[model samples]
Target: MLDVQSGGILLPVFDSVRALAFVGDLSMGQPTDHSLRTGWIAARIAEAAGLDASIGDTVREVALLRWSGCTANAAGFADVFGDDVAVRLAMLEARPGWAEAREAPGDAAALMRPLAQTHCEVSGEIARILGLSTSTETALRNIFETWDGAGLPASIAREEVPVPVFVVALAGDLEIFNRVYGLERALELIEQRSGKRYPAFLADVAARNARDWSCAMDEASLADFDAALITSGMRRDARAELIADVIDLKLPWMTGFSRAVAMTALACCARLGLDEAAQACIYRAGLIHGVGRAAVPNAVWNRPCALPAGAWERVRLVPYWTARAGKQTGTLREAAELASYAYERQDGSGYFRGADARALSLEAQILAASVAWVALRSTRPWRAALPSDAALQTLRHEVASGRLSGDVVDALIAEAGRSVGRPQKSATQNSLLSVRETEVLRAISRGASNKEAARELAISPSTVRTHVESVFRKLECSTRAAATLKASAMGLL
Candidate 1:
């Protein structure tokens, strides 16, 4: 299962570090080959530092995973930088002190302290779970550390740090900077930062061999990095599930949301008599469907009320990010596509592409229905859990309204019928929505006047007007008709 033929070289596909590096590359706003480049450079640095070749793979592993936790603290980063990817790219461009001194632009300690801690925690845990070396895990935990003990999460000073870890850190920066700038400028920057952020020795070696070292791994097609890793000997199959675990931790409430969705989606497919290949794809797709959630900030995702139009737009793009990252993992491409379609609706109002029912595949249809079924029964900040009957009514209502596929809905409802009360994962990230807001929006969509909406919702007319204004503003419309349209598009109705 690991072997894939790419450009006539048999390369292992999606091995742990290789797969994660692809996702990390996207999260860091670097190319998909970033991790591979860094790993190659780090291995060379290790060799030059007089380290033996026996543990060569460990050096590469550390480099590949240095930024593996990029997604874990993304919301915190986005909270300060507006766009997490942009902030990370900018942070990399400016070097070590940039965040606290300038890029943070807010309460740097308040925002960055937690983010730094989270990066180490998540990356270290992942390395441990993957059964990587104790040293590799240590290296990942200290990924942010500089030579002068300035890293956050922990500031373990020089001697406590392993030499290989230090070498890998320098290599990652060297590779990135070398790629962005020509070899000369890259060497100049490293020469400047020596003894401060990086050790002078590693910089000296990198500077001397800058040209050849930077281009050594370039001739190999990007697809072959996994092969090189596989040749180095690591397994690849369980990577999707492992990545799902990482994605699940992005939100406190969504701890096991993706696994639940995958399981439920598979039951729907199995009930409909789909093939095993189809079943496997949907299962994997469900596991990482919410990976995109990491790219969206908690400030928007954790709102206990309805989101404004701009926030909703950001919410819609979550699936796109997932698909983009997934595509980079060639082995997961199909599964990723299914995950991307997780939010599409039959009425053509769903986003990231707004693909209508005609454009959606059977897997997409089933995934969407399964996601909706799971979401409706899960509790959120805005409301109590919907009872089975109420959740079913809500789902059925969508099918009747031509917003979802009837066949897929029937299969999902059938699975629900067969299953007993199992714990549901948090269905959707909805701090950006309020139950009251949805109720009011639904009423308005049906052309209810403020007084009419108030009467229906058991609120005063003045209070209803306040909610109406809030809805109008959040949805970014000046009129009731536009609010109704936007709400329908957002599935708030």
Candidate 2:
């Protein structure tokens, strides 16, 4: 981890990148760290083929951020295909010309073009907002572009595609194939798709050296795999926290809920005798366990009345999304998995899986109790915040009735006495924005692309995109128009 601590805070480039990748995986219906593994493969192929270190680094960054825009265009996707995740998974599995068929409610081109464009634009905007290089932004915007001009929205062919984009694209498919099939099939598939999806040169390279990449993927741990992608610079942790900030905005009253849960989880960890790595995992997992909340619509979350049967199923998938995102995050997989059990009960009464005592781990039990503790203390639209004593009594009753574990509830209550506060942002964080998001919000107000704001600010286009993304998340607005209105009302502009 590159500390590059400015003032008192550790630069969070690492955490933000990995966490975003994890969330991005969930967005794409992939396991967490899908991008991370792709990045590692891309970098190695670049190095083995003797591409410069800069190209390798660019590929890594591009791969990490490839799906950051998945949520940006989610509403558009849902508008066409009801279930956004299901549609995306289908699209990923679809072969060439599959979209030509009328499988959806609307014309595929009409719906998909805008969605793909939004995906590209928002991703590029994020890169610009984060101050990444122009090339990085270009690669991100062109991630869907391919050799044969048959890709989404833009459809730029071969030479028009950025080099890093080429590498990351091939690497992504190879990772999917290699993981799903054996090494030989992964290599053969690369050969099959060479002319159309990826460059022939890249495919040949991946095919020839498939074993090495496959071996590394088979052996690497999340910690080991991540350590290799380090690029020297002042990386900030703002984006990492900002992602959680966005996810929490799903419900109007859920502000700061993730941070509170994270703090309580860490507090409970002290009593569990967990190792430092385990504790850190628990904390990160808590922070992002709600990342999937973005998939659930606000109407369902804010409904004062009971959800209809249809709405109930979507509600059930919320924790599934969290666990899915966490499972893809190589390093945080354990913690993410544990945190997903937050809504579970010791008896077969919890949601999603309805796991009982035999299924839930000690860490999962602790995390669930912590999440309940925070929810009880926090104000919800339906009720006033529970008094501490009342909350404890209620939790105890749940435990006695076989809903929650007695040991976990008791430990959580005991941990409550040693109260801790949420982590604070540094005063040195960007000034005009007060929230690194304001810049992106302002850009949206002006109707600028990531490229436009990057030119004006003289920063990388990627940085602008990243900031705009953060703004959308922090403000909880989906469109530029909505974001602009929210910003003005809040006096952010």
Candidate 3:
């Protein structure tokens, strides 16, 4: 039996982290290997500076994870800059005009503080969940801090910012600037910001040997990093659900969308009498199918009118990036490859590859149908979510048009119907809480405020408060955020 709320699939820690780094790349408007290259550069910088071996390892992790929180604050960026991807890319490249544009007409720091806080908290939480060292978590939380006390979310100066933060900042600047601008210009820019952005000594060290480092990166392969670059050992498999959660965060309204698709795909597989291995593959594919979604900016996705040719081309490449990321990931490669076909059609009209039914695997077909079903039932910025019957009718129309497999659509609709209003296992059976308290926990886990949960549950604010307190007490957590994290780990959410 598949638990829809549980994202408990096992994956290697590196595979999950690297896949997430791909998401970070898309969110930052960089290529898929941008984080990987950043990690390599940071490790090299730490080595050249004669940092401890342990610090070098942590530097690699911090560099790869520097942009981990980008998804958490993407909507906030889109709100401020209209095109989050473009604005972030400009900021990274230090394009001559961005400083003026970034600070124009308002107190940018005041507006950026909250967004930075959200990013740091979420990044720190992800590190903690991965069971990384406290130092790594600390570095991630202060990733945006500057040497001069001008950074947002606290304005902590000099020694307060973690060493890995400085190392990664310089490494990122080297990676981005060296690529965007040549070594001479990149070195000059780093020299100018030396005291303000990072320590002057580190910048000098980089300026002296940046040419050699860039050449080494060009010649080195990812396998070389595995043998040479030091990284923390992950003894056990991490949860794949975290990947889904972070991917959905790129579009806030789509929270839980990946898990829904995964669970529905699993249910459809079972209904279709697929074997357990096939079911797991389909479920994993469903969760990761949206990895490419990060490549497109939030602005393009939010547009109400029909997309122009260029925008439509970007939309079609979503699964292409997902597949590309999977090919780079060792453990989840198969699932990722299948995930890339989530948009294919039976009649050969789908995107990124346009493979017909003959070329599509059964698992791919099932996943494609599952994605369509869940997407139809979920609301988007341009339209309200279709009700269940309406969603079903839409799928039926697709099936009739020869674009979807009839059997797959029927199985999905059956699973969805059976799941509607189904009573979940009681909280008493899973944890020490009443049914109402479980409901409150679920509501808050989705980021609802007490008043909002109260309104949604049709109970008074005080009653909601009572249940919330009981939930926190029973969970032994002092804050809603802590409670949510604990509950998610325990599969209570």
Which candidate gets the maximum TM-score versus the true structure? 3
Q: Of 2 and 3, which scores higher on TM-score?
A: 3
In each prediction, how many residue pairs overlap at the backbone (N, C-alpha, C within less than 3 A)?
Answer: 2, 20, 0
Q: Once superposed on the true structure, which residue ranges of model 1 sit more than 4 Å away at CA?
A: 1-14, 75-85, 95-114, 179-182, 215-220, 231-233, 236-239, 303-314, 380-385, 421-493
Ranking by lDDT: 3, 1, 2
Q: Of the candidates shown, which would achieve the greatest lDDT relative to the real structure?
A: 3
Give a tens-digit lDDT track for model 1, residues 31-109: 7678787777777787777777644667777777777777666655766666677667778776555565344556665
- By summed lDDT, which 10 consecutive residues of candidate 1 come out lowest? 1-10
Residue lDDT tens for model 3, 140-184: 889889999888688998999988999999999999998988888
Candidate 1: lDDT over CA atoms? 0.70
What order do candidates take by TM-score, descending? 3, 1, 2
Cα miss at 388, model 2 (Å)? 18
Please say which candidate is ahead in lDDT: 1 or 3: 3
TM-score of 1: 0.74
Cα lDDT tens digits, model 2, 1-493, are: 2111232112256556666676677667776667888888888888877788888888888989898777666555555665566556556644455454334666665667777776776677656555677888888888888789988877779788888887888888888877777678777777878888877887888887888668767799877776877565315433344455445433335655776777677767767677766666667667777876655654455566777999889878878877776544544566667767878888978878999989988777877888888899876656778999999998999898998888778778777765546464553243335444665555445445678777867778888787877766776545564454334323345
State the lDDT at 253 in candidate 1. Answer: 48
